[model samples]
Each structure stands twice: as structure tokens, then as C-alpha cells.
Target chain A: MTAKTTKFVQGNEACVEGALYAGLDFFAGYPITPSTEIMELLARRLPANGGKFIQMEDEIASMCAVIGASLTGRKVLTATSGPGFSLKQEALGFAVMAEIPCVIVNVQRGGPSTGNPTHVAQGDVNQARWGTHGDHAIVALTASNHQDVFAMTVEAFNIAETYRTPVILLLDEVVGHMRERLTVPEAGAIPLVERLRTSVRKGVDYHPYLPRDDGRLPMSDFGGVHRYNVTGLFHDMWGFPSDNPGVVHGLIRHLMDKIENNAHRLAHYKTYHLQDAETVLISYGSAARSALHVTENLRARGERIGLMELQTLWPFPAEQVARECGHAKQVVVVEMNTGHMCQMVRAALGPPARVFLANRMDGVLITPTDIKAHLRLIAGRGV
Target chain B: MSVQDYIRERFFPHIWCPGCGHGTVLNNLVRAVETLGLDKNEIVMVSGIGCSSRIAGYLDFHTLHTLHGRALAFATGVKLSRPELNVIVPMGDGDALAIGGNHFIHAARRNINITAIVMNNRIYGMTGGQFSPLSGEATTATTAPFGTIDPDFDTVALATAAGASYVARTTTYHVQEIRKRIAEAIVHPGFAVVEVMSQCPTYFGRKNKQGDAVEMLRRYKEGTVPLDKQPADPEKIPRGVFVQRERPEYCKRYEHLVQAAMTDGAALT
Candidate 1:
């Protein structure tokens, strides 16, 4: 028989399938809107796959559970949207400081506090970057469609395991609730990467936080032979908390370097019609979908406009944006949130270029026509 | 064996303040863990931020010093991930029931197979004895120095009502009883909670003139009425196993359901 044809699945359901296929063995989450189906699907499916699914009391517990489960050598994950994501901030910070690998799915909705729970909004773009207190590094992926939700969720787990930090799969209500035909390849067809489990023995006195020659530590599972402490406080190579300034400084620097040094591996962005264009449109998450619609329509009208859609939102893809927009006369940034991604685009494009922002924070997604109007306005401005 | 042998000497004298009930709670926990014959490697102790949470640092088990009021959450994760391993949480009044109150209630509600030892001294011990959710009515704490006007929580009753399959309460003075309860809580098939009525001799003690550590234990001994001596009235029933029933544990039920589903799929074949 021929391989089964593609089936239409909700983005959230596809996310669950992708996570299960990626070897996600544990899911600890509290139910919230838009993202609730992700948890609901996992709750039904994880057990059949010889995994555990826990509906925690709240988002804070959901986060802590994932971290604790991850420490025990399980590929753990959690899903939340808007306010639930807010409650997970401290635990996310703890995961970063302790270098525990976990995946957090933040299904975006109109936010600040329980705003537009049933509606779509990409307002969490900035929160995904700076929601957690203190200076920290993060990797966030935005899925524009259901198919990408499946692909990105798997990638989120892999990136989390590889980097030994929490990876945010930022999906908005649009993509999360939307149904699309999904074509998932055989599990082994795509590579599934687990963390680097160092072969360190117990009583050898290992440091869990010790950086490698490249300033990145290959994490060993907690129950494995390696013995080390894991704490939220700053510490040296050993997981024990320390007050030593040298250890504190080195700890922060190493955490930053581990991701920064490998920015090329972590950064992902897609370009459309950039080969010949006078105006470039920068967008991410749900806004990217609308931007694509506008770009295609404008292309049909014989307008030379390009679309730069960001998949990885952090480590900012600075060089790629600067390089691509080098020859373009003007870059127009369209985002659903109040101009958060646009600010980053402006920063990356710098002073020599004129970057215009078309932002909407009224708890509604920027529609294709809305984006088209902004493109027309930007073009109206002589560049 | 010497106290030094029971505890990693380097980790002690513990950070617990002089005469604090947390030390007593910690002593019982260590004893309980030891009695279970759990290999230190096969056991993991996780704690949230607070004085009681500091117990992880003193124990020899593989430990996770986690975020505040999140010990139960973390422990749930740890236990679910490695069902073969034993996981315990040592959290304080505020850590267990205030910032983490929702987790506490839900963990009980889910009846996850794990042991939660809450050191209920009725105040936030680490944050300088602030009035916690479990503090007695009209009691003075740092946050309620003028005398607390807020109603205190009955954690044992709350947990029992929330569906903890095993629930018990004992005070610091009842060390042996507490140890037995801790061991029982550990072996229980569902979410088991042993709420130890500890004495915060440092802040809660000095503030309320509750007496020194020794005297505080004395008061605890004098104050608690044994369960056998309690009246029949539900409202005034003395603390003990406020509720105990054997329900299918969270993991076991999940395992059974999954197996049934898999078998059903097989039969379809």
C-alpha cells in the first residue's frame, strides 16, 4: 500500500504528535486556552507511548515539574498561553540558571492579563525574550502554520536538549487553533538528537555546570553516575551555590557564550522574494502569515516587495537581516504586538537604514489588508 | 551512630536557626529516608525556597534546590520521570501552602504517588517569620506584628479534603510519631502528606513568647490532644489521620489506562 496521505490536524494536536515522536517522555502542564488542546492531546497519547502526563495545579507547578522531570534524564515539556506563561517565568529562570533542558509551549493570546482568551494575538514576542527576571539567554520559535507547529515542536525539544535550557515554542491562537493538512515523515526519517550525556562516573567529583573547551557543558542525566548539585544560585563548575565573584562572573559569561558562540546553529529565518525587491517586510509568528498573504497579493500586482519571516526570535538574527536589507531601500516591520519585533528589526537594521513599523496591540491580529495598507503607506514615503 | 555519621558533617551545622522546628522536621525526614533503605543515588530530595527547603543541601541524597513554593511541583516531575526512584519534598508553611498553595492542593487532589513533608510552623520561617497561610488566627508574625487579622489554614484538613490518599499531622515534640508517619507517608500508594507541627523558636517563638526550642517542644507536647482523646464532633476532632483511604495512585492508574488502550489497539489487529 502507498504511504498514507496527509491528514488535516489542529496545530495544537500536531504539536502533541510531534513532541511524542521526538521522544518527549514527560509532560507537566496546567490547562489554558488555545494551548489546552496541546496538553489535552498529550494527556491522552503520552501514556500509550510509555510516557507520563501530569496536569499540574497551575503554571508554576507545570514549569517546575518539567524541570524536575528533565533533570531525571527525561525529555520533558509543558504548554501554556498568555497568563499561564506569565506564572512560569520564575521556573524558567531556574531552568536557565540550573541549565536544565525542557520545552515550554507558549500559545499566544491577547494578554497583559487574561485579555482576549479566545482570540489570537502575537503580543508575547517581547515577553518570550524578557519575561523571566534577571539577565538570561533564550531560544524561541514561532510557527506560522500547523505543519510548522509539528516541525518546530520537535525542533524545540531538540534545541532544548542540545543547549540544556528551556526552549520556547511560541505559537499564537491563529496557528494553534487553525487546521491544516500535516505530512509527518517516519520518526527515524528525521534525526532525533538527545543531549550529550557525558560518561563521568560517580565519586570522580564532577561539576555539572563546568563548561567545555567551547564554554558549553555537555549535560549528563542527574541519576547517572555523575554527581553534582543543581541550584538556582550562581555557582562555579560544581552545581553548589557560591558567593565567589569569579565564579559568578564566569557562570553568567559561560551561560551566555554557550548559546552565543553557536548562534548560527540556533538562529533560523526565512526569506521570500528578497532576490529583487525595493521594500522588505519583516515579521514573525502570526504576523508572518498575514505578511506572506500581503506579499503574495502585492507580487501579483507586480510590486517588488520581499518578506523576511523569523523562525528563531532570539540572538536576533542580526547579521542576516542587516546583510539582506543592505541593498533594499526601506524595510517595513509588521507585527501583531505593539511593535516589539519591529524594534528588534530596527536595531538590527541600524541608523543608516529607514525602518518603518506597522504594529497592532488591540488584541487582534494584523490582517493581510492591514499589512498591505502599511506597505502602501511605507511606499508612499519616498525612500 | 554519631549525628555526624547520619548527616554529612560538612553540610552541618545546618542553616536552621537555633531552636527552629525545621531542624526537628529535617531530623525526622533523614531518619525516614534512611529507614526505607533507599540508596542515596536512588533517592532525590527536592525543595522550594524557604528555611525548610534548605534541607536538600544537608541531605546526602541526590537533591534539587528548586524555586520557591515549587518543591511539590518539582518533586512531582522527579517522581513521574523516574518511578523507580524515591522522591521527597521538605517545604515550610509558606513554601508549601502560600506561594505554592495551588500546587499543594492539586498534588493532593491528583494523589500522585510521592511523599510531601510540610514543616508547618504556622509562619514563613525563612522570610523572618511572616504570617503564613497556616498561621493561627490573631497570631503575630513579622507581616502581622500588630496581630494577625487573617484566618489561618488547617493544612491537614485541607489536604484530606483535596484528596490526599494518606494524611497525618504530628508536632516536633512527637519526634518518634512524626518519623513513623513520615515513613508511612513515603510508602503510601498515593499522594501522602505528613504535616509536622514544628516550632519556629527563632521568629515565631521569640515574637509570641512561645519559649525557647526546648520549651517550644514542651508546649507542643502539652497542647496537642491525642487522636484517641478527641471528641466525636467533626469540627473539633483532634489532628491525626484526618483522612486516609486507598485510591489508585496517579501513576498506577495512568499505567493501567495506557495498557488497556494498547491492548485494545492490539485486539483491533
Candidate 2:
């Protein structure tokens, strides 16, 4: 049977399709607002695809289960919203420390503690980077529309598998609930990245955390002939817990360098009409939709305004932001949160650009009208 | 191969106290695996954080030392991913009953084919003799120097009520019984819990005024009553299997459901 190439799908539903296409065979999650549909869809479809889906008792267990399933050489996923994401922080850290490959989708709602359950919010932008304690790096992606949601979900999985780290797909209620037409790629068209398993014989020369030339150690399945130890503690090259300062320093450096040194390759963004633009708007997730609309309207009116929509958030795409915003006289960061990503934008641009923010956090999205008004104000002030 | 063959020699001279009952429990666990003739590679040992949880690191098998109180959840992942592997979790009282109580009950409810060996030492030995959920009422602990008013849990009863297909209780002092029950649990087709009442001499013993590990073992022997015997004192904890019955295992049922779904082609939904 041939697969449908085009279909009207909600952002959350597209996430499920993306996961399946990316080779996700195991899903463990609990029901949470906005994100529940992703889990529900997977629960219905995973079994049909001969995969496994389980509704764990809570988000913590869900995260732990995802990590465990990943250890068995299966691509695993879990979805949750704000409060549930809070509960998953520790387990997420565990995945980082152990270098397990998995994907986590956070359909973000307003929260400081279940502040608003059914509304859109970008409050988790910082949490996605610093939610888990300790010194670590993470890859987070935001989806602006249904098609991007589907495509980014696959990219999230690939990034996770390539880095052996948990990649967070941060979606807000706007895109999560909105339905749009998406062109599903045919099978074999979407590139899939699988975890690199060691070629060494099982018991001959297997070291769990020993790094190859490229700085990543190949993974081994739990039930495979390559029996090795997996732990949450800082460990030596053999995956055994160690307290030696030198070993620990090297471990931390390697973990950081893997993502930092390759940030250029991992960074992803789209620039619309950025050439010779005098003003640029920086946005991500659902808020980027408004920025795009405003940029198009303003450009038609002969305004030198462009938009730089960020698909990858964490590791911040600093160099790309700096290069894209270099020629612009002013930059405005638009978001549903008060000023989360705006800080990073300002940090990337630094002094002299007069960085401004157009934000809303009252469970309402930042509209194109708001961005237009902000631009008008800047134009009138002539500052 | 002998039990000693299962020991990860690189981690020898374990960090457990000289007379701590954890050694005895580990010995029984290794013997149980040996008796079943299960290949070491086919067995995955998991543990949460605690004195008992450390056992996973010293065993010669695919092992995961997970977050505190999260071993059962991790083990569930392993068992579901590869149903053929024998997944075993060794957790402390706090690790099993306190922080991980939700996972414990839910795992039993699902009746997943993972053996949870809860080493109930009554006190949080790793955290320096603090009160645990399994510590009896009025028991003096570091956290409760004046005496604890909290009630204790009957682990066997709790496991049985939580829908565990197999439940048994034994003390570390009963080496042969521990080995027998552990072997039985490993072979059980569904969720099985064997709660081993281990002794913590360093903290539990000194804090409670019980003599060292030897005296604690003697006291445990005196306190436990065989399941078939009825003691006049209703407070005495019962020993032996409290529940063992047949039910479809979680992973097996999941596999069957997958097969049905594949054959019916979305009609099952």
C-alpha cells in the first residue's frame, strides 16, 4: 500500500508521524495537556507499526522508561507539557550524564507550576537549556507550523542519535493545536540517523564510554552480547564511576566539546529577505509565524525589515544570529514569553543595535499587529 | 560455575560494612542466577541509589545503576524492550517504598516480568540510619532520635495488594530461604517481589541499641514467624510466599496485542 503524501494534520499529530518515520519504536509517556494528543496518537499507531507504547504513571517514570528503552537499542520518545516536564528534569539529567539517545517533546503551556494549562507560552525556553542541573549541553528545537513540526521532530531524533543526548522538541499550544496541510515525505526520502554501535567483539575489547577519533563512543544494547555498565555517576573511559579530578575534567570537556565544537553543523535557522535589510526580527516557535507575516507585509510596503526564524534553540546558534544581524540597524525579538529568547538575541547581537522586544505572557500570542506597532514606534522615535 | 564466578573481581572488597547482611543477600542472588542456569549476558541487574542498590555495580552482568528510587521504571524499559532478558532490580527500603512507591505499585499493577528484590533494612543505612517507610513505629533512628511514631509497612502484604503475581518475605539470616525464594521469583512469569529483611549493623544496630550484626540476625530470627504457623503475638511479621498465581505477563500481552493489531490492520482500534 502506498502512503498518503499530503494530509491535513495538527502539529501534535504530525509529531507522531515524524517520530514513526524517524524510526521511533518505543514510546513511554503520561497524559498532560496540549501534549497528550502526541502520546494518544502514538499509543494508537505504535502498536499498528509493531512498536511499543506505554502510559507510565508519571512523567518521571516516563523519562526513566525512555532512557531504559533506549539502552536496549530502540529509538524511544516521551511527550509532556510544563508541569510534567518539570518532573522529568532529573531523569533528563540522568540521560545527559549517561549519554543515552532519546527524544522528548514538551508541548509547552503557561507555567511556574501549572500556571496555565490550556494556553500558549514560551516559558520553557530557558528551562530547556538549564532545567536539568549540572554543567551540560542540550539540543532544543522549536516548531513554527505543522510541517515544520513534522520535519523538526525527525531532525530532533537525528540530532539526539548523532550526539547520544536527549533532544527536546519544544512546542507551544498555538502550533500544537493548529491544523495545517503537510506534505509527508515518502519512505526512504527522510534521512534517519541510527546510534553508532561498537564493532568490537562483545567481551574482547568493549569499553562503554571510550571515545573514538570523533569524540563519541559507540553504544551497546543492554541485551546484546556486549555487556557493559551504565551509570549516572561521572565515569572513566570504561564507564566505571570515578572521582579522579583529571578523569572528571576530561569527561565534562568531551561532553561539552562534542556539541560546542560542532555547533556550526548542528545550528539551523532560516533567513527571509535578510540581505541589506536595515531591521531584523528574531523569533522562534509559534511566535515566529507573526514575525514572518509582519516581515512580508513591511517588505511589500518598502520597509527594510526581515525575519530570522530560529528552528534550533539551545546551543543558541550564536554565530548565525551574529552574522545575520550584523548589517541590521535594529533587531526586535518577538515571543510569547516576556523576554526569554530576547536575552539570547541581545547577547548574540551585543551593543549598538538597540535590541528591543515585543512579548506577551497573558496566555495570548504575540500578533502581527503587535510587531507592526513596535516597528512603527521604532520608526517614529528614529532612535 | 560457582557463585564466585559471577563476582566482578575488579570491584572486590565491597564497600558494605564487614557484617552487613547485604553480602548475604548478594550471595543468595548470585546463587539464584546460578541455579537457574541463566546465561550472565541474558541477565540485566538494575538498582536505585542505596546500600543495597550498589550490588548492581559489583555483579558480572549487564547492569544499570539508575537514579534513586527509579530502578523499577528503568527495569520496565529493559524488560519491555527485550522480553527475553531476565531483568532484576535490587532496591533499598527507601528506594523501593518511599521515593519510588508510585513506580513500585504501578509495576506490580502492570504485572511486568521483572523481579524486584527489595532489601528492607528498616533504616536508611546509606543516608546514615534515617527513618524509612519500612521502619517500625517508635523505632529510634538518626532522623528520629526521640523515637519514630510512624507506622511500618508489611512489604509482603503491600506487594500482594498491589497485584504482584508472586510475593515472598525472608530475612538475610535465612540464607537457604533467600536463595530459594529469589530463584522462584526469577522463574515466575509475572511481577515477583521478594522482600529480604537485611540487617544494617553500622547505623540501625547502634541507633536501636541492638548488639552488632550477630544480635540483629538473632532478633530477626526470633521476630519472624513461618507463614504456616500462627503466633500468639499478632505483631510478628510472617515469612514465606504470601501470593503466587498465574496472570498474563505485561510484555507477553503487549506482544500479543501488537500481533493482533498487525493482523487486523487498524480494525482493532
Candidate 3:
């Protein structure tokens, strides 16, 4: 007898497989609809691999625990949907300030406040960027389908470890709960990034907050021989809270520069049939899958409409989008939420590019036909 | 305790105000670590934003001073990630019970294998003298100019109800009793909360007209009734090791279950 080679898995379950393959050793989460399967799978699987799983009382605790585990040298992860994501904002800020590496999967549902628990919405697109209170750079990935969910989750882990920051895997409820066949590669088959470790030499003082001239720093874990202090307040290389103006300026500049310097490597997007096109469709997350399908369908009908799919939703992939949108006569943005990512597209397009937004906030996905209909409307107008 | 110890020597310039009760609480905590005989490398201290939270940065062990009101959350992560390490958190009243109140309740409820010592000084001494959740009703502070009409929380009772395996309370004046309870809480093997009824003489004492530090100590000694030895009056219930019991520690149970699964896999083959 042999094990089944391929089994149908929910997008949420594929997320767990990705985390495990990415070397995630701890899962601290609070259960919410649409994202509950990620928690459930980890609850069973993590303990089997000498990893830890904790169903925290709420999303705030969940985020804190994940950051905590990351500081102690474990690859940690957590999952939540709408209300839970709202609860996690403060701790998310802590992760940003302290530069802890962890992965947060927000299987998004409708709401400013738990509007529809079991329904799908991409209302969190802007939230994922500015949900936490601070001026900081965020690394977020949007998954279009189950396969992308698995692959992007692994990418999220690698990016977080490489940069030493929290990476959000943004998924809508439609993709998260929907079942599909997934083929996960063997653990060693894919690329995995581990955080840079330090060498211990007694008598040499180690500054955990030491900023590289390039603005990046390696993490020093707890129990290492290095005498290091880690704090949330603005600190010098020694990690003690400092009120000095120069130190404060240097600290904020360095923190921002670390991610900004490597923005080219961290940013990613996908383009579909943009060659010799007058009209283009720009979308992301679950809606991007529809955009891709609709772009293909429109191409078959001799319509020259291209598609620009955002893989890295944050830091916006502004340069690539500017190049694509700059050429097109008209660009239409399609998404589940109203005018969130569209605002970014408009900003990137500037003036002279007629921008049309097709949005829905009714806890339902925007279909390919709906987007195509909007494109046809834009195509018909002359004045 | 030796002044030459790695932990103590590094964490000097302790920030407690002169004759403040937090010093005694810190002293007892250090002694408890000494009594446990755990290696300095194996101990991890986590704290939040406050005067008490500053202890982590000074300590010689692996330490993290996380965001305000989120120490237990971070401590939970540290302890769970490295189950072999002994974790401790010492926080002030507002840092532990008010801003961090949700974490406090849930940490107790999960009964994670960590010891949290809350220095309950009844006021937010670090940020001027605002009334804390643990400050008693009718107590006067900077924020509560006339009187605090809000009811104070009985943190020990809250921990007990929240499922802490070991819960205890002692005033800073009772140094020996506090030291003993700290040791007991450390050894209990589950989520243990030792609420040290501390004094903030500069802020809380002056505002309430509780005299100087010495007078505040006297008031604590007179007001609290001991758990073992009872006062005749019902109102004078003493504060000394109020709750203690054995329960399943969270991380240990998780460790056992995983080991069992490994064994079962071996047997199946």
C-alpha cells in the first residue's frame, strides 16, 4: 500500500503545508472563520515535528506570541481573518519596531468590524499596509489560487527571515476555504532562507541593534553568548532606550533603509498579455485570478486588453506598474473592496491615463464577466 | 546574594525610588532565582513598558523588553519556543494588570509554564501618578484628584479564577514571606502569579497622605491579614501566600504528548 500522491486540500491547509516546509516551528493563533483551517492543521502537525502550537485567547496574544517565538530563534506563524486581524494591529506594530521575523496569514473576510464572518472581502488590502500605527515598510503577498497560496506562503517565510520582519500572506475567504488539488514538493526541494547567525567570541561586546552601513542587521537570539539588549523604544547600537536626537534620527532612518535598500528584491508582480495593448486590467488577490481568466477570454475575442497582477501588494511594485500603466490609454482596476488598491493604481498612472475602478464590497467576489463588462464600457467611450 | 553575580552586576542602577518596595520585590525575585539553582544562561526575563519593565535590559540573562502591555504574550512565545529555558516576568501594576490585563488573564487560563511576579504598587508611578486598575476605591492620585470611584481589582483572586496553578500575595514589608512565596511560585511548574503589594512612596504615598515610605510600610503591615494566621476581625484578611496548588503545566504536557507520538510511530513500525 502507498499513500495518496495527491489529495484535495483547502487553500488554508495548503498554507499550513507551506509554513511547515518553510521551517516554521511554532504556531500561535486564534481561530476565526475562513482562516480556522490553518490553525487546525498546525495544531495537529506542529507538535508532531517537535514544534509548538498554541491556540491563544485572542489575535493580539497570537501576534505577540509569534513575535516572541521569533526573537528566541524559532520560525513562528499565525493566522486570522477580519476581526482577529483588527485585534492584532498593536502587536504588529511591535514586530515592526523591534524587527522580529514572523509570518502572519490574514484570510480576509468582510468588515471594518466583523461584518460577515464567513464571507469573502478584500477590504483589508489597505489595512495590511497601514493597519498598524506607524511609519514603516511592510512585505505582503497576495495569493490568487491554492497553488499560489502554498508557494507564496513559503516565499513569505523566506522574505521575513531574509529581512528580519513580519510578512503578511493576504488571502480572501473565497480562496482560503475553497478546496483544490495541491502537490507539495519535498522539504529540501525548494529554496529556504534561514536568518543569518552570529559567531560567539568572548570579550567582544555584541550589539543586537547594530546597523549595517547598508541599513540591515542580523538577529541575535536569546541564550547566545553575546551580551545584547533588545527594546521597542528607539535605542542606539547598545539597545538601551535613548532620547538623543541624532540617535533617534539614525535609528528611524536605518530601520526604513533596511527594507527600502532591498525593495527591488522584495517587490514582485505578474503581467499578462500587455504587448501592443490599449486597455489593461490591474488587480490582485482572488480577484486577480478572475482578471487573468478574463484577460485570456478577452484576448480570444480579438480584444487587446492586458492584465497586471500584483504578487507583492505592499511597497506597491510602483516602478513595474508605472511602466505598464504609462503606456496604456485606459486602465481598469478590479477588486473585491471599493477603491483601495485602485487609489494606488491611479497614483502610479498619474494624469492622462483614464482610470476606471470596478469594485464590490458586498462580501462576494468580482467575477470575470463583471470585470469584462466594465472594460467594454471603458472601451466604448470616446469623450 | 553576591553583588559580583553576573545578573546583579549588570543590572545595577536599579530604578526604584528611594525606600520604594519594588527594590525588596526585585531582591526576593533574585533570591528565588538563586534558590532554584538554575543556570544564568537558562533564565529569560521579559518585561513591558514601565519602570519595572526596565529590569530586563539590566539583567545578565537573555532578556527582551517588548512593547507596553504585551510582556506575557512575548514571554509565552519565548517559553514555548525554548521549553528548556526558565522564563520570568516582573512588571508594574499598570504594565501587568491594566494595559496587559488580557494577556494576564489568558496566560493564567492556559497555565503556561512561566512565573510572573507583578509589583502591584497601586498606581502608575512611572507615568506620574495615575490611578491603576489595582488601586483601591476612594484612593487619591494625580489623575483621581478628588477620589477614585472605580473599584480595584483583586489580582490574586483574578489569577486563581483564571486558572493559575499557583497564586500568592504579599506586601513588600514582609520580605521573608515574599521570598518564600517567590520560591514556591517558581517551583510550582505552571502559570504562577505572585502579586507583591508594593509601594510607590513618591507618587502614591504623597498623594494619599500615607506619610513617607516607612509609614506606607506600617500601613501595609497593619492593613493586611495573613493567610495562615487569621485576624479576629473579618475585614482584616491577611496577604500571605493566599493560593497554591498543583496543576498540569502547559509546555510540559505538550512535550509529553509529542514524545508519545514519536514512541507510537516507532512501535507501529
lDDT of each: 0.82, 0.90, 0.83
Number of the candidate with higher TM-score, 1 or 2: 2
lDDT of 1 by residue, B18-45 (tens): 7778877778777876787666677778
Off by over 4 Å in 3: A1-5, A381-383, B7-15, B233-237, B260-269
For model 1, how many clashes?
Answer: 0
Where in model 1 is the C-alpha error above 4 Å?
A: A1-5, A300-302, A362-365, A381-383, B1-6, B230-244, B265-269
- The prediction achieving the highest DockQ against the true structure is 2
Clash pairs, model 3 backbone? B225-B237, B225-B238, B226-B238
Name the TM-score of candidate 1.
Answer: 0.93
Best by lDDT: 2
TM-scores for all candidates: the values are 0.93, 0.98, 0.94
For model 2, the superposed segments whose C-alpha errors exceed 4 Å read A1-4, A381-383, B231-235, B266-269
Computed on C-alpha atoms, the DockQ of candidate 1 is 0.53
Per-residue error for A24 in candidate 2, Å, reads: 0.5
The sequence of per-residue lDDT tens digits that candidate 1 reaches over residues A1-383 is 02433668888988887887789989988889989998887776777667788887778888999998898889988999999999899999999899998999999999789899988888888888999998888889887877778888888988888888889999988888888888877757668888887767657766677777866567766566654567898866767667889988888887788887777888788899998888898888777888998888888999888998888887678888888887888898887877887788788878888898887777677888787677667768532
Better of 1 and 3 by lDDT: 3
lDDT of 2 by residue, A1-383 (tens): 13648888889988988898899999999999989999888877889888889989889999999999999999999999999999999999999999999999999999899799999999999999999999999999988988889889999999999999999999999899989998888887878898898888855968889888898879888888877778898997767778999989988898898888889988888889999888999999989999999999989999888999999998899899999999899999998887988899888888876888988888988899888888889778532
> For model 3, how does the per-residue alpha-carbon lDDT over A1-383 read when each residue is reduced to its tens digit?
02224558889988888888889999999889989988888777777677888988778888989988898899999999988888888888778878889899999999988699888899998889999886887888988877778889999999899878889999989989889998887657678999976563755777777866655577778765665667888887777778899998887777677777677787777788998777888888888888889889989989888998888888677778888878888898888988888898888878877889987789878888778678667768522
Per-residue lDDT value at A285 in model 1 = 75
